[model samples]
Target: MKTLLSAIILLSSVSAFANCPEFKVPKKFMARESLFSSRATDMTFDAGGNRIAKIEERLLSATTTFDLYDNKRQKIATARQRMFSGGTEIEIKDCAGKIIGKIKERVFHNMFDIYSKYSILDATGKVIAESEKKEILAPSFSVTGTNGKQLMKMRLSTFSTRSLDEWVVEILNDTQADPRILLMIPAFKTSADNRETEK
Candidate 1:
Protein backbone atom coordinates (compact mmCIF):
# COMPACT_ATOMS: atom_id res chain seq x y z
CA MET A 1 0.00 0.00 0.00
CA LYS A 2 2.83 2.40 0.85
CA THR A 3 4.59 1.81 -2.50
CA LEU A 4 1.33 2.31 -4.39
CA LEU A 5 0.64 5.58 -2.63
CA SER A 6 4.17 6.79 -3.35
CA ALA A 7 3.77 5.98 -7.02
CA ILE A 8 0.47 7.85 -7.18
CA ILE A 9 1.98 10.95 -5.58
CA LEU A 10 4.89 10.89 -7.97
CA LEU A 11 2.57 10.71 -10.95
CA SER A 12 0.57 13.65 -9.66
CA SER A 13 3.68 15.73 -9.23
CA VAL A 14 4.78 14.98 -12.78
CA SER A 15 1.40 15.94 -14.13
CA ALA A 16 1.47 19.21 -12.24
CA PHE A 17 4.89 20.04 -13.59
CA ALA A 18 3.72 19.43 -17.14
CA ASN A 19 0.70 21.68 -17.00
CA CYS A 20 0.78 23.06 -20.51
CA PRO A 21 -2.64 22.55 -22.02
CA GLU A 22 -2.88 21.41 -25.63
CA PHE A 23 -4.83 23.75 -27.87
CA LYS A 24 -5.38 22.84 -31.48
CA VAL A 25 -5.06 25.80 -33.79
CA PRO A 26 -8.15 25.92 -35.87
CA LYS A 27 -7.76 26.33 -39.62
CA LYS A 28 -9.53 29.66 -39.53
CA PHE A 29 -10.77 31.88 -36.71
CA MET A 30 -13.10 34.84 -36.89
CA ALA A 31 -12.99 38.27 -35.27
CA ARG A 32 -15.98 40.53 -35.35
CA GLU A 33 -15.96 44.22 -34.60
CA SER A 34 -18.89 45.86 -32.89
CA LEU A 35 -20.89 47.89 -35.35
CA PHE A 36 -23.02 49.87 -32.95
CA SER A 37 -20.21 50.57 -30.50
CA SER A 38 -16.49 51.04 -30.59
CA ARG A 39 -16.09 49.29 -27.30
CA ALA A 40 -15.29 45.66 -28.03
CA THR A 41 -14.48 42.86 -30.48
CA ASP A 42 -15.37 39.19 -30.22
CA MET A 43 -13.09 36.41 -31.43
CA THR A 44 -14.33 32.88 -31.97
CA PHE A 45 -13.30 29.55 -33.36
CA ASP A 46 -15.70 29.90 -36.27
CA ALA A 47 -18.36 32.18 -37.56
CA GLY A 48 -21.05 32.50 -34.83
CA GLY A 49 -19.30 29.77 -32.92
CA ASN A 50 -17.95 29.55 -29.41
CA ARG A 51 -16.33 32.77 -28.24
CA ILE A 52 -12.79 32.19 -27.07
CA ALA A 53 -11.77 35.74 -26.27
CA LYS A 54 -12.75 39.39 -26.29
CA ILE A 55 -10.88 42.65 -26.74
CA GLU A 56 -12.36 45.71 -25.12
CA GLU A 57 -11.34 49.19 -26.13
CA ARG A 58 -12.48 52.25 -24.25
CA LEU A 59 -13.41 55.30 -26.15
CA LEU A 60 -10.87 58.11 -25.75
CA SER A 61 -8.83 55.92 -23.41
CA ALA A 62 -5.21 54.97 -23.84
CA THR A 63 -5.56 51.47 -22.43
CA THR A 64 -7.00 48.50 -24.33
CA THR A 65 -7.84 45.23 -22.58
CA PHE A 66 -8.26 41.63 -23.72
CA ASP A 67 -9.89 38.74 -21.86
CA LEU A 68 -9.30 35.12 -22.82
CA TYR A 69 -11.61 32.33 -21.76
CA ASP A 70 -11.81 28.61 -22.15
CA ASN A 71 -14.64 26.67 -23.74
CA LYS A 72 -16.66 26.81 -20.54
CA ARG A 73 -16.37 30.61 -20.43
CA GLN A 74 -13.94 30.50 -17.54
CA LYS A 75 -11.49 33.38 -17.69
CA ILE A 76 -7.95 32.20 -18.29
CA ALA A 77 -5.97 35.42 -18.62
CA THR A 78 -6.31 39.15 -19.16
CA ALA A 79 -4.04 41.50 -21.06
CA ARG A 80 -3.97 45.26 -21.09
CA GLN A 81 -2.15 47.62 -23.42
CA ARG A 82 -1.24 51.23 -22.79
CA MET A 83 -0.32 53.42 -25.73
CA PHE A 84 2.24 56.16 -25.24
CA SER A 85 3.79 58.77 -27.47
CA GLY A 86 6.73 56.53 -28.23
CA GLY A 87 5.15 53.08 -28.54
CA THR A 88 2.62 50.68 -27.04
CA GLU A 89 3.25 48.48 -24.05
CA ILE A 90 1.25 45.41 -23.05
CA GLU A 91 0.92 43.54 -19.79
CA ILE A 92 -0.31 39.96 -19.70
CA LYS A 93 -1.69 38.77 -16.39
CA ASP A 94 -3.29 35.64 -15.08
CA CYS A 95 -6.76 35.44 -13.61
CA ALA A 96 -5.47 36.42 -10.19
CA GLY A 97 -3.99 39.59 -11.72
CA LYS A 98 -0.37 38.50 -11.55
CA ILE A 99 1.53 39.74 -14.56
CA ILE A 100 3.11 36.87 -16.42
CA GLY A 101 4.59 38.74 -19.36
CA LYS A 102 5.13 42.13 -20.97
CA ILE A 103 5.25 43.13 -24.63
CA LYS A 104 6.84 46.34 -25.84
CA GLU A 105 7.11 47.57 -29.36
CA ARG A 106 10.55 48.30 -30.77
CA VAL A 107 10.64 52.06 -31.12
CA PHE A 108 13.38 52.04 -33.76
CA HIS A 109 11.21 50.16 -36.22
CA ASN A 110 8.41 52.73 -36.02
CA MET A 111 9.80 54.75 -38.88
CA PHE A 112 10.39 51.75 -41.14
CA ASP A 113 7.72 50.18 -43.32
CA ILE A 114 9.46 46.91 -44.01
CA TYR A 115 8.82 45.24 -40.67
CA SER A 116 7.80 45.91 -37.07
CA LYS A 117 9.18 44.07 -34.06
CA TYR A 118 8.11 43.62 -30.47
CA SER A 119 9.87 41.99 -27.58
CA ILE A 120 8.01 39.76 -25.16
CA LEU A 121 9.36 39.86 -21.63
CA ASP A 122 8.70 37.66 -18.66
CA ALA A 123 7.81 38.81 -15.17
CA THR A 124 11.46 39.51 -14.44
CA GLY A 125 11.72 41.54 -17.68
CA LYS A 126 13.69 38.91 -19.55
CA VAL A 127 13.00 38.59 -23.22
CA ILE A 128 11.32 35.19 -23.62
CA ALA A 129 9.68 35.78 -26.97
CA GLU A 130 9.91 38.06 -29.96
CA SER A 131 7.31 38.89 -32.61
CA GLU A 132 7.82 40.39 -36.04
CA LYS A 133 5.39 41.42 -38.72
CA LYS A 134 6.31 41.45 -42.39
CA GLU A 135 4.64 44.22 -44.32
CA ILE A 136 4.14 42.39 -47.61
CA LEU A 137 1.12 42.48 -49.88
CA ALA A 138 -0.22 39.57 -47.87
CA PRO A 139 1.03 40.39 -44.38
CA SER A 140 2.08 37.72 -41.92
CA PHE A 141 3.49 37.65 -38.38
CA SER A 142 5.68 35.17 -36.59
CA VAL A 143 6.59 34.72 -32.92
CA THR A 144 9.88 33.21 -31.96
CA GLY A 145 11.49 32.15 -28.72
CA THR A 146 14.59 33.68 -27.16
CA ASN A 147 16.69 31.06 -28.91
CA GLY A 148 15.24 32.16 -32.27
CA LYS A 149 12.97 29.15 -32.64
CA GLN A 150 9.62 29.85 -34.20
CA LEU A 151 6.77 29.39 -31.76
CA MET A 152 3.75 30.51 -33.76
CA LYS A 153 2.90 31.72 -37.24
CA MET A 154 -0.18 33.66 -38.24
CA ARG A 155 -1.34 34.49 -41.76
CA LEU A 156 -4.00 37.01 -42.57
CA SER A 157 -6.95 35.39 -44.30
CA THR A 158 -9.40 38.19 -44.87
CA PHE A 159 -9.32 41.88 -44.18
CA SER A 160 -11.94 43.41 -41.90
CA THR A 161 -14.29 45.40 -44.07
CA ARG A 162 -17.52 45.92 -42.20
CA SER A 163 -17.67 43.18 -39.57
CA LEU A 164 -15.83 39.85 -39.67
CA ASP A 165 -12.47 38.61 -40.93
CA GLU A 166 -10.34 35.47 -40.64
CA TRP A 167 -6.85 34.71 -39.40
CA VAL A 168 -5.18 31.32 -39.46
CA VAL A 169 -2.84 30.57 -36.55
CA GLU A 170 -0.31 27.79 -36.48
CA ILE A 171 1.20 26.78 -33.17
CA LEU A 172 4.75 25.51 -33.48
CA ASN A 173 6.29 25.33 -30.01
CA ASP A 174 3.24 25.32 -27.82
CA THR A 175 4.85 23.87 -24.73
CA GLN A 176 6.86 27.01 -24.01
CA ALA A 177 4.14 29.50 -24.88
CA ASP A 178 1.54 31.08 -22.66
CA PRO A 179 -1.94 30.65 -24.16
CA ARG A 180 -2.88 34.20 -23.30
CA ILE A 181 -0.07 35.48 -25.45
CA LEU A 182 -1.43 33.47 -28.34
CA LEU A 183 -4.80 35.10 -27.83
CA MET A 184 -3.25 38.53 -27.96
CA ILE A 185 -1.81 37.95 -31.45
CA PRO A 186 -4.98 38.84 -33.25
CA ALA A 187 -5.36 42.06 -31.33
CA PHE A 188 -1.82 43.04 -32.18
CA LYS A 189 -2.37 42.28 -35.82
CA THR A 190 -5.55 44.33 -35.88
CA SER A 191 -3.77 47.27 -34.33
CA ALA A 192 -1.04 46.99 -36.93
CA ASP A 193 -3.56 46.93 -39.73
CA ASN A 194 -5.27 50.04 -38.39
CA ARG A 195 -1.96 51.82 -38.20
CA GLU A 196 -1.21 50.97 -41.82
CA THR A 197 -4.59 52.24 -42.95
CA GLU A 198 -3.99 55.57 -41.22
CA LYS A 199 -0.68 56.03 -43.01
Candidate 2:
Protein backbone atom coordinates (compact mmCIF):
# COMPACT_ATOMS: atom_id res chain seq x y z
CA MET A 1 0.00 0.00 0.00
CA LYS A 2 2.83 2.42 0.79
CA THR A 3 4.57 1.77 -2.52
CA LEU A 4 1.36 2.31 -4.46
CA LEU A 5 0.69 5.62 -2.73
CA SER A 6 4.24 6.80 -3.38
CA ALA A 7 3.97 5.91 -7.04
CA ILE A 8 0.75 7.86 -7.44
CA ILE A 9 2.22 10.94 -5.79
CA LEU A 10 5.29 10.76 -8.01
CA LEU A 11 3.16 10.54 -11.14
CA SER A 12 1.10 13.53 -10.10
CA SER A 13 4.20 15.64 -9.60
CA VAL A 14 5.51 14.74 -13.03
CA SER A 15 2.23 15.67 -14.66
CA ALA A 16 2.15 19.04 -12.97
CA PHE A 17 5.69 19.87 -14.03
CA ALA A 18 5.06 18.84 -17.63
CA ASN A 19 2.24 21.36 -18.01
CA CYS A 20 4.50 24.21 -16.90
CA PRO A 21 6.61 25.99 -19.49
CA GLU A 22 10.18 24.77 -19.95
CA PHE A 23 11.34 28.34 -19.58
CA LYS A 24 14.90 29.19 -20.50
CA VAL A 25 16.64 32.46 -21.19
CA PRO A 26 19.08 32.13 -24.06
CA LYS A 27 22.61 33.32 -23.22
CA LYS A 28 22.83 35.76 -26.13
CA PHE A 29 19.33 37.16 -25.79
CA MET A 30 19.64 37.70 -22.05
CA ALA A 31 22.52 40.12 -22.63
CA ARG A 32 20.17 42.68 -24.19
CA GLU A 33 18.71 45.48 -22.09
CA SER A 34 15.58 46.11 -24.18
CA LEU A 35 12.56 44.37 -22.71
CA PHE A 36 10.93 44.45 -26.13
CA SER A 37 14.10 42.95 -27.56
CA SER A 38 13.70 39.88 -25.42
CA ARG A 39 12.39 36.69 -26.95
CA ALA A 40 9.79 34.35 -25.50
CA THR A 41 11.01 33.79 -21.98
CA ASP A 42 8.31 31.26 -21.19
CA MET A 43 6.85 28.40 -23.23
CA THR A 44 4.17 26.04 -21.95
CA PHE A 45 3.54 22.61 -23.40
CA ASP A 46 0.88 19.95 -23.24
CA ALA A 47 1.30 16.33 -22.14
CA GLY A 48 2.12 15.43 -25.74
CA GLY A 49 4.94 18.01 -25.91
CA ASN A 50 3.00 20.26 -28.29
CA ARG A 51 3.58 23.97 -27.71
CA ILE A 52 0.58 25.79 -26.22
CA ALA A 53 1.75 29.39 -25.82
CA LYS A 54 4.88 31.55 -25.60
CA ILE A 55 5.17 34.89 -23.80
CA GLU A 56 7.67 37.48 -25.01
CA GLU A 57 8.14 41.10 -23.96
CA ARG A 58 9.08 43.77 -26.52
CA LEU A 59 11.79 46.28 -25.79
CA LEU A 60 11.86 48.64 -28.77
CA SER A 61 8.09 49.01 -28.70
CA ALA A 62 5.80 48.78 -25.70
CA THR A 63 3.95 45.71 -26.95
CA THR A 64 3.85 41.98 -26.25
CA THR A 65 3.33 38.96 -28.53
CA PHE A 66 1.86 35.64 -27.56
CA ASP A 67 2.28 32.84 -30.09
CA LEU A 68 -0.08 29.89 -29.84
CA TYR A 69 -0.12 26.52 -31.56
CA ASP A 70 -2.61 23.74 -32.19
CA ASN A 71 -2.15 20.11 -31.19
CA LYS A 72 -1.18 19.15 -34.76
CA ARG A 73 1.85 21.49 -34.69
CA GLN A 74 0.03 24.09 -36.77
CA LYS A 75 0.42 27.76 -35.83
CA ILE A 76 -3.19 28.51 -34.95
CA ALA A 77 -3.04 31.98 -33.36
CA THR A 78 -0.75 34.81 -32.36
CA ALA A 79 -1.40 37.71 -30.01
CA ARG A 80 0.77 40.21 -31.92
CA GLN A 81 3.29 40.25 -34.87
CA ARG A 82 4.07 43.67 -36.40
CA MET A 83 7.10 44.48 -34.25
CA PHE A 84 8.80 41.12 -34.58
CA SER A 85 10.81 42.32 -37.61
CA GLY A 86 10.16 40.01 -40.56
CA GLY A 87 8.84 37.31 -38.28
CA THR A 88 6.62 34.64 -39.78
CA GLU A 89 3.34 36.24 -40.88
CA ILE A 90 0.41 33.95 -40.08
CA GLU A 91 -2.80 33.96 -42.13
CA ILE A 92 -6.32 32.84 -41.27
CA LYS A 93 -7.66 30.84 -44.19
CA ASP A 94 -10.70 28.72 -44.94
CA CYS A 95 -10.90 24.96 -45.56
CA ALA A 96 -9.65 25.63 -49.08
CA GLY A 97 -6.92 27.69 -47.41
CA LYS A 98 -8.13 30.91 -49.00
CA ILE A 99 -6.69 34.07 -47.48
CA ILE A 100 -9.61 34.91 -45.22
CA GLY A 101 -7.57 37.26 -43.05
CA LYS A 102 -4.04 38.46 -42.16
CA ILE A 103 -2.14 40.25 -39.32
CA LYS A 104 0.73 42.58 -40.15
CA GLU A 105 2.17 46.01 -39.28
CA ARG A 106 4.69 48.14 -41.16
CA VAL A 107 6.85 51.22 -40.59
CA PHE A 108 6.64 54.03 -43.15
CA HIS A 109 8.06 57.53 -43.29
CA ASN A 110 6.42 60.78 -44.37
CA MET A 111 9.04 63.20 -43.02
CA PHE A 112 9.17 60.85 -40.04
CA ASP A 113 8.39 57.14 -39.97
CA ILE A 114 4.86 56.04 -39.11
CA TYR A 115 4.33 52.71 -37.35
CA SER A 116 0.85 51.23 -37.52
CA LYS A 117 -0.75 48.00 -36.22
CA TYR A 118 -4.05 46.59 -37.45
CA SER A 119 -6.18 43.44 -37.46
CA ILE A 120 -9.10 42.66 -39.84
CA LEU A 121 -12.27 41.17 -38.47
CA ASP A 122 -15.02 39.25 -40.25
CA ALA A 123 -18.61 40.55 -40.47
CA THR A 124 -19.73 38.68 -37.39
CA GLY A 125 -16.81 40.22 -35.50
CA LYS A 126 -15.79 36.82 -34.24
CA VAL A 127 -12.84 35.98 -36.45
CA ILE A 128 -9.73 38.12 -37.08
CA ALA A 129 -10.23 37.48 -40.75
CA GLU A 130 -7.55 39.87 -42.11
CA SER A 131 -5.17 42.72 -41.35
CA GLU A 132 -3.84 45.87 -43.09
CA LYS A 133 -2.40 49.38 -42.63
CA LYS A 134 -4.01 52.82 -42.87
CA GLU A 135 -1.74 53.92 -45.74
CA ILE A 136 -2.72 50.88 -47.76
CA LEU A 137 -5.96 50.74 -49.73
CA ALA A 138 -7.97 47.52 -49.61
CA PRO A 139 -10.31 46.22 -52.34
CA SER A 140 -13.28 47.57 -50.40
CA PHE A 141 -14.47 51.07 -49.44
CA SER A 142 -12.72 54.41 -49.73
CA VAL A 143 -12.39 56.86 -46.80
CA THR A 144 -14.28 59.93 -47.95
CA GLY A 145 -16.29 61.95 -45.47
CA THR A 146 -18.89 64.28 -47.00
CA ASN A 147 -17.16 67.07 -48.94
CA GLY A 148 -17.35 69.47 -46.01
CA LYS A 149 -17.75 66.96 -43.19
CA GLN A 150 -14.97 64.98 -41.51
CA LEU A 151 -16.80 61.81 -40.58
CA MET A 152 -14.61 60.24 -37.91
CA LYS A 153 -15.87 57.04 -36.36
CA MET A 154 -14.72 54.16 -34.16
CA ARG A 155 -15.83 50.54 -33.82
CA LEU A 156 -16.54 47.92 -31.16
CA SER A 157 -14.65 44.62 -31.12
CA THR A 158 -15.81 41.02 -30.70
CA PHE A 159 -14.23 37.57 -30.45
CA SER A 160 -14.86 34.28 -32.28
CA THR A 161 -14.04 30.62 -31.76
CA ARG A 162 -12.54 28.60 -34.61
CA SER A 163 -13.43 25.05 -35.60
CA LEU A 164 -9.93 24.01 -34.58
CA ASP A 165 -10.71 24.99 -31.00
CA GLU A 166 -8.74 28.18 -31.24
CA TRP A 167 -9.88 31.72 -30.34
CA VAL A 168 -9.94 34.74 -32.65
CA VAL A 169 -10.62 38.28 -31.38
CA GLU A 170 -11.63 41.14 -33.64
CA ILE A 171 -12.97 44.73 -33.81
CA LEU A 172 -15.75 45.76 -36.18
CA ASN A 173 -18.20 48.41 -37.34
CA ASP A 174 -22.03 48.42 -37.14
CA THR A 175 -22.56 47.84 -40.86
CA GLN A 176 -22.89 44.26 -42.09
CA ALA A 177 -19.82 44.28 -44.36
CA ASP A 178 -16.61 42.36 -43.77
CA PRO A 179 -15.23 43.79 -40.53
CA ARG A 180 -11.78 43.49 -42.12
CA ILE A 181 -12.64 46.72 -43.90
CA LEU A 182 -12.04 48.53 -40.64
CA LEU A 183 -8.46 49.54 -39.84
CA MET A 184 -7.58 49.51 -36.12
CA ILE A 185 -4.64 51.85 -35.55
CA PRO A 186 -2.35 51.02 -32.66
CA ALA A 187 -2.55 53.23 -29.59
CA PHE A 188 0.50 55.11 -30.85
CA LYS A 189 -1.27 56.30 -33.97
CA THR A 190 -4.42 58.31 -34.54
CA SER A 191 -7.54 56.07 -34.66
CA ALA A 192 -8.96 55.43 -38.17
CA ASP A 193 -12.47 54.29 -38.88
CA ASN A 194 -13.21 50.79 -40.30
CA ARG A 195 -14.31 38.52 -44.85
CA GLU A 196 -15.15 35.77 -45.72
CA THR A 197 -16.99 32.64 -46.98
CA GLU A 198 -15.64 29.34 -45.66
CA LYS A 199 -15.18 26.23 -47.77
Candidate 3:
Protein backbone atom coordinates (compact mmCIF):
# COMPACT_ATOMS: atom_id res chain seq x y z
CA MET A 1 0.00 0.00 0.00
CA LYS A 2 2.84 2.37 0.73
CA THR A 3 4.40 1.81 -2.66
CA LEU A 4 1.02 2.24 -4.36
CA LEU A 5 0.40 5.49 -2.55
CA SER A 6 3.85 6.75 -3.45
CA ALA A 7 3.25 5.90 -7.07
CA ILE A 8 0.02 7.81 -7.08
CA ILE A 9 1.67 10.86 -5.58
CA LEU A 10 4.51 10.73 -8.05
CA LEU A 11 2.19 10.45 -10.99
CA SER A 12 -0.09 13.23 -9.84
CA SER A 13 2.78 15.70 -9.65
CA VAL A 14 2.90 15.74 -13.41
CA SER A 15 -0.71 16.82 -13.83
CA ALA A 16 -1.01 19.47 -11.16
CA PHE A 17 -3.35 21.54 -13.31
CA ALA A 18 -5.22 18.60 -14.77
CA ASN A 19 -8.57 19.77 -13.45
CA CYS A 20 -8.07 23.42 -14.42
CA PRO A 21 -9.16 23.77 -17.99
CA GLU A 22 -8.46 27.46 -17.82
CA PHE A 23 -4.75 26.79 -17.58
CA LYS A 24 -4.91 23.76 -19.83
CA VAL A 25 -2.45 20.95 -19.11
CA PRO A 26 0.35 21.71 -16.69
CA LYS A 27 4.01 21.71 -17.42
CA LYS A 28 5.36 18.25 -16.74
CA PHE A 29 8.11 18.01 -14.15
CA MET A 30 11.26 16.04 -14.85
CA ALA A 31 12.38 15.82 -11.24
CA ARG A 32 11.66 12.95 -8.88
CA GLU A 33 10.27 14.29 -5.62
CA SER A 34 9.96 12.44 -2.35
CA LEU A 35 6.70 12.17 -0.47
CA PHE A 36 7.34 15.18 1.77
CA SER A 37 10.56 16.77 0.58
CA SER A 38 10.33 20.46 -0.27
CA ARG A 39 13.41 20.87 -2.42
CA ALA A 40 12.59 22.75 -5.63
CA THR A 41 13.70 21.02 -8.79
CA ASP A 42 11.92 21.01 -12.13
CA MET A 43 11.86 22.03 -15.76
CA THR A 44 9.67 25.00 -16.65
CA PHE A 45 7.93 25.55 -19.97
CA ASP A 46 6.19 28.34 -21.81
CA ALA A 47 2.64 28.38 -23.19
CA GLY A 48 3.95 27.17 -26.52
CA GLY A 49 5.14 23.97 -24.78
CA ASN A 50 8.79 24.81 -25.39
CA ARG A 51 11.19 24.11 -22.56
CA ILE A 52 12.00 27.40 -20.86
CA ALA A 53 14.54 26.57 -18.21
CA LYS A 54 15.55 23.97 -15.64
CA ILE A 55 16.00 24.61 -11.92
CA GLU A 56 17.85 22.49 -9.42
CA GLU A 57 17.80 23.42 -5.73
CA ARG A 58 20.23 22.08 -3.21
CA LEU A 59 20.65 22.52 0.52
CA LEU A 60 23.97 21.86 2.18
CA SER A 61 25.04 22.92 5.65
CA ALA A 62 24.28 26.63 6.11
CA THR A 63 23.98 27.44 2.44
CA THR A 64 21.27 26.67 -0.13
CA THR A 65 21.79 27.20 -3.83
CA PHE A 66 19.62 27.00 -6.92
CA ASP A 67 21.13 26.59 -10.37
CA LEU A 68 19.18 27.67 -13.42
CA TYR A 69 19.97 26.40 -16.87
CA ASP A 70 18.74 27.13 -20.34
CA ASN A 71 16.95 24.59 -22.49
CA LYS A 72 20.30 23.65 -23.94
CA ARG A 73 21.29 22.65 -20.38
CA GLN A 74 23.88 25.41 -20.15
CA LYS A 75 24.23 27.19 -16.87
CA ILE A 76 22.60 30.60 -17.14
CA ALA A 77 22.60 31.81 -13.60
CA THR A 78 23.14 30.69 -10.00
CA ALA A 79 21.23 31.86 -6.94
CA ARG A 80 23.14 31.47 -3.69
CA GLN A 81 21.06 31.83 -0.55
CA ARG A 82 22.03 33.34 2.79
CA MET A 83 19.61 32.70 5.61
CA PHE A 84 19.15 35.09 8.51
CA SER A 85 17.13 34.88 11.69
CA GLY A 86 14.90 37.66 10.43
CA GLY A 87 14.67 36.71 6.78
CA THR A 88 16.60 35.34 3.77
CA GLU A 89 18.68 36.76 0.91
CA ILE A 90 19.60 35.19 -2.39
CA GLU A 91 22.27 36.62 -4.68
CA ILE A 92 21.95 35.88 -8.35
CA LYS A 93 24.96 35.80 -10.69
CA ASP A 94 25.07 35.19 -14.38
CA CYS A 95 27.22 32.60 -16.12
CA ALA A 96 29.84 35.29 -16.67
CA GLY A 97 30.15 35.49 -12.88
CA LYS A 98 28.65 38.94 -12.53
CA ILE A 99 25.96 39.75 -9.99
CA ILE A 100 22.73 40.46 -11.78
CA GLY A 101 19.95 40.44 -9.24
CA LYS A 102 18.98 39.77 -5.63
CA ILE A 103 15.97 38.28 -3.89
CA LYS A 104 15.51 39.33 -0.29
CA GLU A 105 12.76 38.57 2.17
CA ARG A 106 11.29 41.47 4.11
CA VAL A 107 12.02 41.46 7.82
CA PHE A 108 8.67 42.94 8.77
CA HIS A 109 5.24 42.63 7.24
CA ASN A 110 2.05 44.37 8.28
CA MET A 111 0.91 42.96 11.59
CA PHE A 112 -2.71 43.07 10.48
CA ASP A 113 -2.06 41.50 7.11
CA ILE A 114 -1.10 37.90 6.50
CA TYR A 115 1.71 38.38 4.06
CA SER A 116 5.34 37.40 3.84
CA LYS A 117 6.98 39.88 1.51
CA TYR A 118 10.15 39.79 -0.56
CA SER A 119 11.93 42.24 -2.77
CA ILE A 120 13.66 41.66 -6.06
CA LEU A 121 16.50 44.04 -6.74
CA ASP A 122 18.77 44.70 -9.66
CA ALA A 123 22.53 44.69 -9.29
CA THR A 124 22.53 48.45 -8.91
CA GLY A 125 20.35 48.03 -5.78
CA LYS A 126 17.18 49.22 -7.43
CA VAL A 127 13.95 47.52 -6.51
CA ILE A 128 12.81 45.82 -9.66
CA ALA A 129 10.01 43.66 -8.37
CA GLU A 130 8.22 42.40 -5.26
CA SER A 131 6.92 39.01 -4.26
CA GLU A 132 4.46 38.04 -1.57
CA LYS A 133 2.20 35.20 -0.64
CA LYS A 134 -1.24 36.24 -1.84
CA GLU A 135 -3.19 33.14 -0.91
CA ILE A 136 -3.78 32.24 2.71
CA LEU A 137 -4.95 28.67 2.34
CA ALA A 138 -2.32 27.49 -0.11
CA PRO A 139 1.02 28.52 -1.60
CA SER A 140 0.44 31.30 -4.11
CA PHE A 141 2.59 34.35 -4.74
CA SER A 142 2.25 37.52 -6.76
CA VAL A 143 5.28 39.11 -8.36
CA THR A 144 4.68 42.75 -9.06
CA GLY A 145 7.09 45.00 -10.91
CA THR A 146 8.42 48.26 -9.54
CA ASN A 147 5.53 50.04 -11.23
CA GLY A 148 3.22 48.38 -8.69
CA LYS A 149 1.70 46.23 -11.38
CA GLN A 150 1.45 42.47 -11.47
CA LEU A 151 4.20 41.03 -13.65
CA MET A 152 3.94 37.38 -12.79
CA LYS A 153 2.62 34.78 -10.35
CA MET A 154 3.53 31.44 -8.87
CA ARG A 155 0.85 29.14 -7.59
CA LEU A 156 0.18 25.50 -7.00
CA SER A 157 -1.56 23.72 -9.81
CA THR A 158 -5.27 23.12 -9.30
CA PHE A 159 -4.78 19.37 -8.89
CA SER A 160 -1.76 19.59 -6.61
CA THR A 161 -1.89 17.24 -3.63
CA ARG A 162 -0.63 17.44 -0.09
CA SER A 163 2.11 14.90 -0.62
CA LEU A 164 3.64 16.76 -3.53
CA ASP A 165 3.45 20.47 -4.35
CA GLU A 166 3.49 21.08 -8.06
CA TRP A 167 4.03 24.75 -8.86
CA VAL A 168 3.00 26.84 -11.83
CA VAL A 169 4.82 30.09 -12.52
CA GLU A 170 3.11 32.46 -14.93
CA ILE A 171 4.02 35.85 -16.31
CA LEU A 172 1.04 38.18 -16.32
CA ASN A 173 2.55 41.24 -17.96
CA ASP A 174 5.36 42.26 -20.28
CA THR A 175 8.73 42.96 -18.77
CA GLN A 176 12.39 43.57 -19.66
CA ALA A 177 13.83 41.47 -16.82
CA ASP A 178 15.95 38.52 -17.66
CA PRO A 179 13.85 35.42 -18.18
CA ARG A 180 16.18 33.47 -15.92
CA ILE A 181 15.71 35.93 -13.11
CA LEU A 182 11.93 35.77 -13.45
CA LEU A 183 12.02 32.01 -13.69
CA MET A 184 13.82 31.60 -10.38
CA ILE A 185 11.06 33.42 -8.46
CA PRO A 186 9.13 30.19 -7.96
CA ALA A 187 12.11 28.36 -6.55
CA PHE A 188 13.06 31.31 -4.41
CA LYS A 189 9.55 31.52 -2.99
CA THR A 190 9.55 27.79 -2.38
CA SER A 191 12.78 28.04 -0.41
CA ALA A 192 11.48 30.94 1.63
CA ASP A 193 8.14 29.26 2.33
CA ASN A 194 9.84 26.03 3.34
CA ARG A 195 12.09 27.89 5.76
CA GLU A 196 9.12 29.66 7.32
CA THR A 197 7.29 26.36 7.70
CA GLU A 198 10.29 24.89 9.51
CA LYS A 199 10.20 27.74 11.98
Clashes of each: 0, 10, 0
lDDT scores for all predictions? 0.65, 0.30, 0.66
TM-score of 1: 0.69
Stretches > 4 Å off in candidate 1:
1-36, 46-60, 107-114, 158-164, 195-199
**Better by TM-score, candidate 3 or 2:** 3
TM per candidate comes to 0.69, 0.24, 0.69
Error of 1 at 181 (Å): 1.3
In model 1, how large is the Cα lDDT of residue 51?
Answer: 64
Residue lDDT tens for model 3, 1-199: 9999999997786465233211122233322222325544443444455655667787778788888776677677888988778888888887756787888886555655456678888888788888887655776778888888898777787756654455766667775455666666666665555666767
1 versus 2: better TM-score goes to = 1
lDDT by residue (tens digit), candidate 1, 52-166? 5555433336566766666656566677877777677888887657677888875444454566677878777888888887866766778999887888777767664534445
Best-to-worst lDDT order = 3, 1, 2
| Residues 128-151 of candidate 2: C-alpha lDDT, one tens digit per residue | 422333433211212222232212
Using lDDT as the yardstick, the better of models 1 and 2 is 1
